[model samples]
Target: MKAIVCTGYGPPEVLQMQDVEKPRPADNEVLVKVHATTVSMGDHRIRSFTVPSAVWLPARMALGLTRPRRNILGIELAGEVEAVGGQVQRFKKGDRVFAATLQGFGAYAQYRCISEDGPVAAKPRNLTYEEAAAVPIGARTALHYLRKANVQSGQDVLIYGASGSVGTYAVQMAKHFGANVTAVCSTANVELTQSLGADAVIDYTADDFTTRPDRYDVVFDTVGKASFGDCMKVLKSGGSYLNCTPVLPSIQVMRAKLSGAHKLILGEAPPETAEALDFIRELLEAGKIRVVVDRKYRFDEIVEAHRYVDQGRKKGNVVISIV
Candidate 1:
C-alpha cells in the first residue's frame, strides 16, 4: 500500500509519499480499499499545528509531542470493502462505503481498516466516490451544529462563511429544515450561495451584514471570523448563536446563557455516526442535497491540495482521488 506520511507537524512539504504495509481488518473490523478522500481544513490545521492558542499544549500532547502520532493525515474516505472480519455483520466484501475516521486519520493510505459499527455506511447510490468522500466531515459538522441549535422552520437563519466547506453544507441543511436562509460570503460567491437554497445572500465585501435591520433566529459562524458581539446584535432576542470555532469571547456567551435570554452553542462536534451518514445518504438519493466540490487532486498531489486549502478560499470540499 502507498500512503502520504506526515513526517512532522510543519509545512505541507512535510507530507511525503511512501510505500507502507497495507492495513488488515481485525476480528470486528472491515478492510477498505480507498477510492477517494478529502483535504479538510482540520487536516491542514493538524498537519501545520495551526490551532487556537488556548489548546496549543493539549493539541501537541494529543497529536504528538514532536511529530504526529498518526503518520497519515486524512480524516474521511469513500471506499470499497475488500474484506470483513467474521464478527462484522453490517458489511461484507464488495460493499461500497463512506466514513469519517475522525481522530483516527489514516484515509490518505490506499487501504484502511475500521470497525464495522463505526461511522461507516453504504455510499449513496447516486453519488460518485469522490462526492461521497466529501460529505462526512463538512456535512456531519454542519448537521450536528444545526441540530444542536434546534433550528426551526420558517425562521431566519444566517450562515457566515457560506462559501467554505462547512458553510456550504450548513446553508443547504438549514434550508432542508425549512429555515429562511441568509448566506454571508464575499462578492465572488453570491451566486453560489444563492444556488444552494439560501433565501438571501450577503456580499460581505460590499456590505456589513450586522448593520442591516433584518434579524435572524439563528446565526451560525462556521469559520469563526465574526465577532460574537456583532453576531449577537443581528440575532433576535431569543435567537441562538452557534460558533463552530470558538474563541475566548465565546465563553462570555456561554455564561450569559445562565440568564435565559439567548442560546449559545460552541463546542466540538459529536462523534460521527452511521445514522447521520444514512440521513445524508437519503438526502443525496432524493436529490435534496448535492456535494459541492471546488477542486480535485490526485493522491500524489496531496501537498499541493493542502497548500490550496491553507489559502482558505475554496468554495466547498477539496477531494483527493486515492485510486
Candidate 2:
C-alpha cells in the first residue's frame, strides 16, 4: 500500500509518498480501502509543530519530541470495507463508510483498519467519497460547540472566519437549528457564506465586524483568528463565545466565566461517535446541508494539498482522492 509519510515536523515538503504495508483488521475492526481523505488545519499545525509558546512543551510531548508520533497525517476518511474481522457486527464486507481516525491518526494510506465501534458509519447515499471524507472533523466540531452553547432558535449568532472548513459547516448547522446566523469572512467569501444560509454576512476585510450594533447570543471563532475581546464586545449579556482552535485551558476564559456576564467556552473535539455521524448523514442525504470542496488532490499530491490549506484561505474543505 502507498502512504504519505511524515518525515519530521517542519514543512509540507516533509510529507513524502512511500510504499507502506497495508493494514489488516483485528477482532472488532474492519479493513477499509481508503477512497478519500482530507488535510485539515489540524494536520497542517501538527506537521509544522505550530503550537502556542505556552503549550509547546506539552504539545511536543504528546505529538513527539523530535517528529510526529504518527507518521501518517490524515484524520478522517471515506472508504469501502474490504474485509471485517470475525467479531465485527456493525459492518461487513463492501459497506461504504466514512470515519474519523483521530485516535490513531493513520488515514493517509491506501488501506486502514478501524474499530467498528469507533466513529464509523455508512456514507450518506447522496454524497461522493470526497465529500463524505470532509465531514467528520469539521462538521463534528461545529455541531459540538453549537450544542454546548445551547444555541436557541431566534437567537442572533455570529460566526467568524465563516469560509474555512469548520466555519462553513457551522453556518449551515446553526441555521438548521433555527438560529439567526451572521457569517463573517473576507469580502471574497461573502457570496459563499450567504449561499450557506447565513441570515447576514459581514465582510471583515471591508469593515470592523465588532462595530455592528446588533449584539449576538452566541459568537463562534472557527479559525482562531478573531480577537477574544472583540468577540466578547459583540455578544449580548449572558451570551456565549466559543473558540474552536483551543490548545490549552485558557486562564482568561476561566476568569471570564467566573466574573464576566458572558461565557467563554473552549473545548477539544468531542468523542467521535456513529450516532452523530448517522444524524449528520441523514441531514446530508436529505439535502438539508451541503459540502463545499475548494480543491481536490490525488494521493500523490498530499504535499501540495497541505500547502494549499496552509495558505489559510480555503472556502471549505480540501480533499485528497486516495483510491
Candidate 3:
C-alpha cells in the first residue's frame, strides 16, 4: 500500500509519499481499500500546528510532543471493503462505504482498517466515491452543531462563512431543518450560497450582517470569523449562537450565560457515529443534500491539494482520488 506520511508537522511539504504495509482487518474490523478522501481544515490545522493559543500546549501534547503522533493525516474516506473479519456482519468484501476516521486520522492511504461498528456506513447510491468522501467531516460537523442549537422549523437562521466546507453543509442542513437560511459569504460566493437554498445571501465583503435590522433565531459562525458580541446583537432574544472554530473563552460567552437572553454554544465537535453517517447517507439518497466538491486531485498530488485548501478560497470540499 502507498500512504502519505507526515514527516513531522509544519507545511504541506512535510507530507511524504512512501510505500507502506497494507493494513489488515482485526477480528471485528473491516479492511477498506480507499478510493477517495479529503483534505479538510482539521488536517491542515494538524499539519501546520495552527491552533488556538489557549489550546497550544494541549494540542501539542495530544498531537505529539514535538511532531505528529500519527504520521498519516486524513480524517475521512470513501472506499470499498476488500475484506472483512468473521465478526463483521454488517459489511461484506465488496461493499462500498464512507466514514469518518475522527481521531484515528489515517485515511491518506490506500488501505485502512476500521471496526465493524465504527463511524462507517454504506455509501449513498447516488454519490460517487469522491462525493461520498467529502460528506463525513463537513456534514457531521454541521449536523451536530445544528442539532445542538435545537434548530426548529420555520425559524430564522444565519450562517457566517457560508462558503467553506462546514459552512456549505450548514446552509443545506439548516434548510432541511426548516429554518429560513441566511448565508453570509464573500461577494464571489453569493450565488453559490443561494443555490444551496439560502433564503438570503449577505456579501460579507461589502456589508456587515450585524448592521442589518433583521434578527435570527440562530446564528452559526462556521469559521469563527465573527465575534460573539457581534453575532449576539443580531440574534433574537432566547436564540442560540454556535461557534465552530476553536478560540479562547470570551467575556461575551460568560455575559450571555449570565444574562440568559441568548445561549452561547461552543465546544469540541461531537464524536462521529455510525448513526450520523447513515443519516447523512439517507439525506444524500433522498436528494435533500448534496456534496459540493470544489476540486479534485490525484492521490500523488496531495501537496498541491493542500496548498489550494490553505489558500482559503475553495468553495466546498477538496477531494483526493486515491485509486
Per-model TM against the reference: 0.97, 0.97, 0.97
Candidate 1 local lDDT, residue 80: 99
- lDDT for every model? 0.91, 0.90, 0.91
Q: Kindly provide the TM-score of model 1 when superposed on the true structure, using C-alpha atoms.
A: 0.97
List the candidates ranked by lDDT, beginning with the highest: 3, 1, 2
- The superposed Cα distance between candidate 2 and the true structure at residue 136, in angstroms, equals 0.8
Show model 2 residue runs off by greater than 4 Å.
247-251
Q: Looking at model 2, which ten-residue stretch has the lowest summed lDDT?
A: 246-255
> What overall lDDT, based on C-alpha atoms, would model 1 receive against the true structure?
0.91
Among all windows of ten consecutive residues in candidate 1, which has the lowest summed lDDT?
A: 246-255
lDDT of 1 by residue, 1-323 (tens): 89999999888999999999998799999999999999998898889999889888988998998889997889999999999998999998999999999858999999999987788999999999999999988888899889988987899999999998899999999999999999999999999998999999999999999899999999999998998888988999888888887466446576667778788888567665688889889998998888999999999999999999989899999999998
Candidate 3 structure quality by residue, lDDT tens digits, 10-71? 87999999999898788899999999999998898899999878889998989897779888
* Tens-place lDDT digits, model 2, residues 133-235: 9999888889889988998889899999999988999999999999999999998999999999999998988889878788999999998888777887888
For model 1, the stretches where C-alpha displacement exceeds 4 angstroms are 249-251
Local lDDT at 296 for model 3: 99
Clashing pairs in 3: none
